[model samples]
Target: MKAIYLESINAPFVLIEKEKPTAGPGEAVVQVKAAALNHRDVYIQYGRYFTKEYPAILGSDGAGIVTEVGAGVAPDWVSKEVVLDPSTDWGDNPGVHSKEYKVLGMPQEGTFAEYVKVPATNLHEKPAHLSFEQAAALPLAGVTAWRTLFTKCALQPGEKVLITGIGGGVALAALQFAVALGAQVWVTSSSEEKIEKAKALGATGGINYKTENWGKALKADVGGIDVSIDGAAGEGFVQLVKVANPAGRIGMYGGTTGMIGQINPAEIFWKQLNIYGSTMGTNQDFAAMMAFVREKKVTPVVDSTFRLEETEHAMRYMEAGKQFGKIVLRVG
Candidate 1:
């Protein structure tokens, strides 16, 4: 099997031939057809995120065909096309994950290889409407967005919703899901072009956050938003607060821009707004996300596809913050 191995933090990804892994008990070996890049992968590469080991494979989102089933696994799983739920050991709590919870990749070998092994329970039939590349794009980002909007915030149809930093995968997935659910969605992006692109994907409108008074502009132009999904939590976070309606719901997943500064406590309590922190979701969340994707015929926005060996180029592209959607790697 050919795999991209990271020898250490900040080390270059090396494509090397390695022994194919066999399915362990309750696991299956998947012949990876495609893998997708996430911001978490970049963070791991830079040694900024969770990683307890070196010489590791680094990918969390994948779609492929099951080639082998381990002992105790159903033989019927073999030969079935599947997408992996990267979230593992989510435990019993619906509202929170246990200490045992972890996402794939990092300490465990991941999908950036010709073959990768995962628990049989983590596999779901790929949505028929999506190709391998698109299915690969959905798992991490789609589940996160689904849990953030539907589970955490409980967004309703016809509500005015805003998604911050619209070009990234999770944010774009939220935009798509909210729009499909009949919410009037708005977005923010530093790039006017990306904003227009988001609008083409069903966003009601968007704003360039680089402009002065953009938050006020949103409040004045679009009116107060009933829900806001945010990833970047630096300087612009106050803007999201400014644009929220009374009793608005805000769900945050990542703080990509760094720590937030200078927020008014009065705005939160006086407005009776609710804010929730979210991350990669549970197995049930993954299932619901897939069902929604299938029901809505949602297609993940794939910005580019690179061959398996082109791992560095894909990482660089994602690091440059230039992608309008998920970046996929063709594995098989």
Candidate 2:
């Protein structure tokens, strides 16, 4: 099997031949067809993640055909096309993950290889509406978006939702999910081009955060937003608070822009607004996300595709923050 090995933090990825992985008990070996890049992968390369293990395979999102199943696993799983959940060891608690929870692609070997092993419980049938590349894009970003909108915020139809940093995969997935659920979607992006692209994907309109007083602009132009899904938690987060309606829910998934400088306590307390923090998601969240994708026929946005050996290039593209959607790697 061919895999991209990250020798160490800040080291370049090396494409090398390696022994194919086999299924252990309760696990299955997937012959990977495609893999997608996430910000986590980039963070791992830059030594920004919690784990510092070296010579690791780095990818979390993948879709492929099952080639083998371990003892105690159902034989029927073989020859099935499935997408990997990548969220491993999510414990019993529904509201939050246990200490045992860990995402794939760090301490564990991941999908940036011809073969990768995963727990059978983590597999979901590939959505009929998506191809291998598109299926690979959905697991991480789709689950994050799903948990943010439906689980944490409980976004409803016909409501106004705002997704900040519209070009990233998770934000784009949120846009798709909200639009399909009959919500009026709006977005914020530093790039006007990305904002226009988001509008083409069903966003009502968008604002460029680079503009001074953009938060006031949103409040003036769009009235008040019922929900704000934000990944960047810098000063712009205050903008989200400004545009939110009273009792609006704010879901924070990532703090890409670093610490928030200031926030008005009165705005939150007086408005009775709710703020929630979300990560990847639980197993139940993954299941419901896939069901929604299948039922809604949602297609994940694919910005581009690179060959498996081009994993380094894919990572660099994602690091540049130039992609409007998921950047996938063709594996098999």
lDDT score at residue 44, model 1, on the 0-100 scale: 84
What TM-score quantifies how close candidate 1 is to the native fold? Answer: 0.98
What is the C-alpha lDDT profile of model 2 across 1-332, one tens digit per residue?
89999998899887999999889999999999999999999888999997788879989999999999999999999999999999988789889988888888888899999999999999899987899999999999999999999999999999999999998999999999999999999999889999999989999999989999888888899899999999999989988888999999999999999999699899999999999999999999999999989889999999999998888888888888889999999997
lDDT of each: 0.93, 0.93
Off by over 4 Å in 1: none
Candidate 2, pairs of clashing residues:
none
How do all models score by TM-score? 0.98, 0.98
Each candidate structure's count of clashing pairs: 0, 0
Model 2 alpha-carbon miss at residue 70, Å: 1.0
